[model samples]
Target chain A: MSMRDRLRTMGLGAFGLLLVIVSWEVIGRNQLLGRTFPALSDVLATIVDPARRGLFQRALEATIGSALRGFVFGSIIGFAMAALGVIFPPLRAGLDRLAAVMHAVPLIALGPFLIVTLSREGTPTAIATLAVVFNVFVATSAGLRVGNPLHHDVLTVLGAGSWERFRRLELPGALPFIADGLKLAAPAAVIGAILGEWFGAPRGIGIVIVSSLQNYQIDLLWSAALLGAMLSLVAFGAFSVLERWVVGRFR
Target chain B: MLSPGAELSSESDKSADGSTDPSIEHDDISISTSPVLPHVDASEIGPANLSLSGVTKRFPLGRNDTVLALDDISLDIAPGEFVALLGPSGCGKSTVLRLLCGLEEPTGGDVRIRGCHPSELVADHRLGVAFQDHALLPWATVADNVALPFKVAGQPVDNDRVRSLLELVGIAEFAKARPKQLSGGMRQRVSIARALALRPEVLLLDEPFGALDAVTRRRMNLELQDIWSTDQITTVLVTHSVEEAVFLADRVVVMTGRPGRIQTIRTPGFERPRSPELLRSPEFHELVDELTIALDEEPA
Candidate 1:
């Protein structure tokens, strides 16, 4: 693509983001929804408040750390399962159905049950892992199947064993797809971690948001929400960069 | 007859169970475009005899329905013989190649290579095949794609062999380039080079030039002739082009459409190292016309 085309795309994206922010400020400044939704300035003020700096810092670190841990664990497990299913095809249907059933269970219902079994502290990471698993698994499985039939035949007649076929053909072919999954799963994992934190986690942005809402500190609540959104967006952006690189190399 | 220079034709078409490789030990090729193309010592690579006796292939179409792709098709390819299976679309010419390559199991009869199962020959890394798609890995360079068979066979990549094959196919300079970077014809050359990397005994080609334009396809056909002359390995090519079959093969086996049966087999008496001069000769056109008519003839 030309430099001008790239710049235009970037310009459009910035414009879209600016429009959303302007709309939010307009609505919040007008006391939209009876002051429950605070103005962007009020939230920014709370974010910049020196007194609350330690509390927000601790909350951001905890949420981000757990979310990243969950993301890595979930992506690895999901990728491994997909590879296993491809290698031993008889297990494919069973694993696919299992993934579907797990995904079908509501997060809210799973939260209480996970809290009882693994306790509130572990629940956040567990839920985050679970949330990322489905997307990663689905993407990887589809990617593995997306290999060209002619490539398969070439490898087959070349006397490539199953392992060789996976190494040379399926794995490389699936890289772009798996990278895309990781990009999408990043935000999901952050969302899951935050939601899991709500089920009585000791400290996190989720905790701050819940307590601030109870105390009617609308600015603090909005600030915590902003922090979670920022973390999710950052994670998404990082993975998107990775996805582009993988596609460049593999596709 | 194998080549003009190496006129080694065994009396019996079928190769004995165990024999030395049947490659034509040609001294040189006249394609001056390439400088000193490396010699292939395919002498160690025994050209395996291929036999498909009363082979029938039927694919399950669901609801207890089956489509008969090949019906009682019997063919025998001598060691170092280049045979082409020509037919209309859906005539199962490609399927025949697939069966010969052990990509598909014959629903009936036996398919053998050198008195063993096709799978057995393949397991020993003795089968080479090029398909219509030029299935080069998008991620790999031309040289890497051509060197794949060595990797598949669990052997270290023979850079020298890969380079020589690339030279043989006239794509030595494009070795560093990826499949997407090359033209359609160039990618097919890489595919063909990959197929030949292992010095496979039997070369199976299913319309390797089918996707190229007319000029490119004809040129590729000529290049293939040059490559084949060096090592006249037992080859079976499946193509719809009558002229291509006549130009390349010692014998052209034409087939009828659907439930494909051998319509007629004709010996295209062309001297090899087939020159471009022969393509314009009356003999080549006459045989091509004969096969074209045979291909169009309805099954009785």
Candidate 2:
């Protein structure tokens, strides 16, 4: 496309963003939920207050660090398990059945048991990691299974060995699907980490929200919620950038 | 008549005296009298260049009966000869290519290349194949797609060789472009370059240009002839178009339907390094007509 067309597309996207912000500001100012719904300005005030008082520097670090650690651990285990499943049919079949059973079990219900079994030492990191693992595991396994049959035949006719075929054809073919799964799992991972914190944790956005609720500190609760949303958006944006880089290389 | 064990040099001299070089002419005299001897000497040299003896392929039909895809098929493709297998859709034309390439095994007979089974020599990079579909990986660039055969065979990339082949196929400028970015004929050219990457002794092409339009197909046909003449690799092309079979092959083996068997082989009496103008001549039409009649007479 021409440069003028590209500029018009970008301009339209910015206009859409402005429309969303205007709607949110108008609704919040009119007290749509009868004072329970915080105004956009009130939430912005709370976010800036912590930074003004200089308390946000430490809290931001603690929340982000725990979430990042959980995401890394969960993704590593998920990918290893997916590779194992592809290599071993029996293991893949077993995992498929297990996933079906686990998916039905609510993630929220597992919180109390995970705290007792894994977080007995009061480490919130372990529980958060556990929550993210299930989501990543399912996504990765599904992605690996989506390799195309025509591409497989191309490898076969080229006389590629089984392992070589997996590396060259199957792995690259599965990448787009795997990247899509990871993008989706990013936000889920953050939600999982924060949820794990809600049951029991020394520090996290979830703990702050709960404490603020107990004291009826509405502004603080809104601030914690906004920070959690920001963390989710950041993780999502990071994966989006990585996905573009990978897809770009292939193209 | 030349026996299976006879040397080709003596037989070739005998055949050349009575008729023009079989490579340039298609005639019934050529078909009936041309030596049926194996291409390469198996005893002194390696295996027969490419041999399929009593090869039969059958698929299970659930009941007691089996569907014979290929039956008692035997042929030898000599190095640097361009042979075309001309048959209708269900004659297992493509199946023969797969069997020779070792993508599928023959149920009843042997597939030998240079004295070894195809499976045994695959690692040596002796076999190359092109399918009906271009089969270029959409994500890979033209150069990368063409380099795949070498990569899979664990050979180092010969960038100069790849560039030359791209130039031969007239697509050197599109090396950095992805397959999706190129036109259909361009993609198939990339596939052809990839098949030649290993300098394979035997090249198998299954209707490689059948999907293209008439104009594109004719252009590709001319390009293929030029490449084949220069490269001198043994080529076996499976095609349904009679014109394609007549234009490209030293011998067009017309196969019967169903339990696919070689019914007749026709030799077109045309001079090679064939030009595009040769395709419009009366001789080409006569050759195409003869194959068409043979095909129509075959049992469905």
DockQ of all predictions against the true structure, Cα-based: 0.86, 0.48
Which regions of candidate 2 fall more than 4 Å away from where they truly are?
A1-32, A51-55, A88-90, A120-143, A248-251, B1-48, B60-66
Candidate achieving the largest lDDT: 1
Report residue B158 deviation for candidate 1 (angstroms).
0.7
Model 2, span A6-41: residue lDDT tens:
999999999998997777678779987666677778
- Residues B84-178 of candidate 1 have per-residue lDDT tens digits of 99889999999999888889999999998876788887887878999999989999999999989998899999999999999988999999998
Chain A TM-scores, per candidate, are 0.97, 0.85
TM-score of chain B of 2: 0.85
| lDDT score, candidate 2, position B195 | 86
DockQ winner: 1
Residue B274 miss distance in model 2 (angstroms): 2.4
